[model samples]
Target: MLFKFRRHWETPWEVVDSKAVKPVYMYYDDEDSLDIVAVSDADTRGTYVFEVNHLTRTALRNAVTFSRQQLIHQVAKKGFNVLVLESWRLTIFRRGKSHRVEVMYSGRPAEALGKLPHLPPPPFMDVLHEFM
Candidate 1:
């Protein structure tokens, strides 16, 4: 019998905070996995964390795949957080702000793209409903 071992990728946490919304910590793995942790209280006692796998990532990417103009319009019309993750970078948009982070895989650095032009409805809505 043969056994296969998978490599583990660790992403350092990046935190974003604002007076209007809860603080959010975002990070990604080498396999295109995204982890989002939202802190609900000032004391960081209550929290909600979402871990998205490759399948969910694919669905999200497909759902938001739109022309630049279309994306800008959709984002302006709907207020929701959007995340785009590629092999080398992770981009996030929330509350009209955008940010990009470089991703390193197996200790190799990768290039990052600019902020996406548009926003799509949150792809994790269904998963969120399950917990509520």
Candidate 2:
């Protein structure tokens, strides 16, 4: 824990809400670069913040996909395939006309020992090359 640039599922904030529920940052690696040794689940604090309560103006991307599909079905029944540091948040309350919707989903659960290598693409994507 000496250095980190940000890769807790890498989500700064960008939910246009066309049916929001977008979070599953593929595979994470902020310089960890595919070392493959993940077995993180330190005594059950692996991280998870599920909260989906709806009833606002109706239609909230299906309550954020029913709270991210019940947090990926309880993290794949606790066996975990891969779910690194994902993040999500969206809250609203009015009360004047009965409005209250929340969709908070966090993540951090891993058990990857195989098949997870495919993440090299960041370095600004080579400045998005396009010289034509």
Clashes of each: 1, 0
Native RMSD of candidate 1 (Å): 20.5
lDDT of 1 by residue, 3-116 (tens): 765445634344432111122222344523333333112111111122333323443233323222243334334332233321111222222233222211111112234443
Query: Which model scores highest in TM-score?
Result: 2
lDDT of each: 0.28, 0.47
- Which number leads on lDDT? 2
Estimated TM-score for each candidate? 0.17, 0.27
Q: What lDDT is reached at residue 100 by model 1?
A: 26
lDDT (tens digit, per residue) of candidate 2 on 32-105: 54444555553222222223244433244455446555765677687865556555555544433344455666
Clashing pairs in 1: 71-118
* Candidate 2 lDDT score at position 26: 49
* Range of the 10 consecutive residues with the lowest summed lDDT in candidate 1: 101-110
Model 1 ranges with Cα > 4 A deviation: 1-83, 86-116
